[model samples]
Target: MADSASRAVFLLQLTDCHLMPEPGQLFRDIDADSQLRLVVDDVLASGLPVDHLLLTGDLVHHGNAEAYRRLLDILAPLPGKRHWIPGNHDEIGAMRAASAMPCGREEVDLGHWRLLLLDSTSYPDGRGSGSLSETELVWLEQRLAQSTERPVLIALHHNPVATDSDWQDEIMLGNAADFTDLVAAAPQVKAVICGHLHQSQARSIGQARFWCSPSTSVQFKPAQADFLLESGGPDASPGYRWYRLYPDGRVESGMRRLAQVAPDPELG
Candidate 1:
């Protein structure tokens, strides 16, 4: 890792890989493993400086231990310290068991800033909806108070802001207002990055920006009233997000998308 005191720390945020336990398994008709590999290949080809790899969530669709292990294997070639949070599809215990890296610790010190990983899957209302628990809220408040000087960047599985897609909006962070209230009060908190909507998006609350990245699997069509899977074209592609966080509280983020993936015709 680069000295955060000297310069900016580059963080790569890859979300929603959705890998299955089986080696050649496909999720939603997409070759989940191959798609992730493509993204990995792109990252290596880009030759980006990566200080930490922050996987926001949904590393595996099956919640199997092997899948989590596989995730590490696939991402092994990438450079940086790795961190991750669980998504709705992940089983916490299994993930912790399977992970070679630290699993339950929520905050990581990147010198100038502290990255906070919240548990949005604490309260799953089934059908993919998630909310932060009261206990988690208290923990967040304490962490914020403990390090008021360090700029904060929060990562979680669910979006804290609505995506405007009716199906996705209903399943967004359930206690968003409460979450927003706390984040709004903290001026040092710079951004919130998430993964569930399966498409790249950015929104805001107060001084904080919310960045939602596309899945490494398949993407959901944005700005829709009904649930719709992106079938073809650029929108259906597998992609990831990256951010360059500087010591002076600057966060630069962008999306890197692989070639388009056509939806499986057999499912239809």
Candidate 2:
């Protein structure tokens, strides 16, 4: 590893691992467990020096115990310091069985970045919302005030802005405008990262950059008018986003897709 002061902070962003016990179903007939394993294998084989692996959420499907167990089995061998925030399909209690990941709040200092992982899965209808409770907002405000020099990266399970698709727009962060106001008020906020959209996108609002990473399982076609699952194709391969954060306040980000070999060639 290079000197922490000079080396760019490298983070791997993974999301939406909707694992199911039975295989060959929806979402391209892609087995979530196998796809996640393939991503980890490729990341390890590439030998990229990653500072942390950040999973934004939907770590499991149906929030079942067995699914969480399978998620653990796949992630146990993957290298690097890991952190996670849950999504709509995840259950806080079930995910706790595998790791000590934050359920609603987390803060970490990585080089020049102060990362705040928020739990934005606060909706009743199995969709996502971004309502930071009064307590959480106060805590975040205090943290922002204290660390004015370091760039802040906020991670959540929902996109803070609409992707302009009707189906997704309806299910996205409900209190996005309020969240945006808070982010705009805090100049230390350099970027906002999230999952749930299952696609790669980068947008700018105020002075901050917002990025949504591709999923480790399936991906939704961006800007499609209706809700639809993607088919098995070159674009649906499991992948992640790599972020390079510079001390001088510049960010260079890119996507990396795993080369997945069908578990059973005959089935395909």
Candidate 3:
């Protein structure tokens, strides 16, 4: 529930952790566990009251039970309800079994705002692209119809629009037109937040805005023709996004990154 006095809901969005079964494992020259720990530490230390933690997707590097256990252990201390969706790298069944917290919730009510969680990884078998089933689209319409007055924010694992990066765009939501068309028709829809691009991107389609957050472990270079990692520069550090949702249907968001890079023992 949002604080009635402030009329604002504070949310933390953490995505693409890519954690491994072992705490010391590395992905793309970045130590996944160490990076995740750094981000989690900063979020808790900020002393900001968060109402919800929206884990967009890619919770693990490999779809394994042990990896989910490690992820859960790292995020144990964070307060608030956590809602998650599956990415290509996640094993849905394994994640549900490993998590003590709720895993896949389609809709959540936060005061006057409603959050819809969609599973874009319809074919979860190492495929980079994503799609929503017919049933999901129908459910989305029903949900939107039911709450036309409340502001809605949708979360999914894949980008619903082009990132201008040819390689990344190819793997984005396959049925983006269908999805966006539905969103465009809904005046109550405020934002669509997503992951899997591994970089921050923002675009506006009609009245709705789409946002993609950077990964907690590594970030990919944006607007590239091919797959590329972001060079270890000041702007390329692992990070998360914070959102402030107001009662009047306004949303404010920003990204936060650690000043120090996660220690990569393998590089040493």
All-Cα superposition RMSD per candidate: 5.6, 6.0, 5.8
C-alpha lDDT of residue 141 in model 1: 87
Error of 3 at 176 (Å): 0.7
Candidate 1: list runs displaced more than 4 Å.
Answer: 1-4, 260-268
lDDT of candidate 3 over 98-204, digit per residue (tens): 87655554799898799999988775434599788788889898998987999999998989999789998889988889899999999999988999988877677
Worst 10 residues of 3 by lDDT: 259-268
lDDT of each: 0.84, 0.78, 0.82
User: After best superposition, candidate 3 residue 102: deviation in angstroms?
Assistant: 4.7
Q: Which stretches of candidate 2 lie over 4 Å from their true place?
A: 21-28, 127-130, 259-268
Residues 1-268, model 2: lDDT tens digits: 7687977888888899887644443444667877888888888887777888888888887656667777777877766688888888778887787667666579988878888988877644544444555676677777778868888888888887989878898888777787788899988888898898998778875889888888998888888889776666756667788778888777777777775422111111
- CA shift at 190, candidate 1, in angstroms? 0.7
Off by over 4 Å in 3: 1-6, 100-102, 124-127, 260-268
Give the per-residue lDDT of model 1 (tens digit) for 1-268.
5454868889998988988878887898888899899899999998988999988788898657877888889999999999988888888887888876655338899998999988888778888978898988998888988879889999888888877799888999889889999999899899888889899887777898778888889889999998899998887888888888888898878777876422211111
* Best of the candidates, TM-score: 1
Best-first order by lDDT: 1, 3, 2
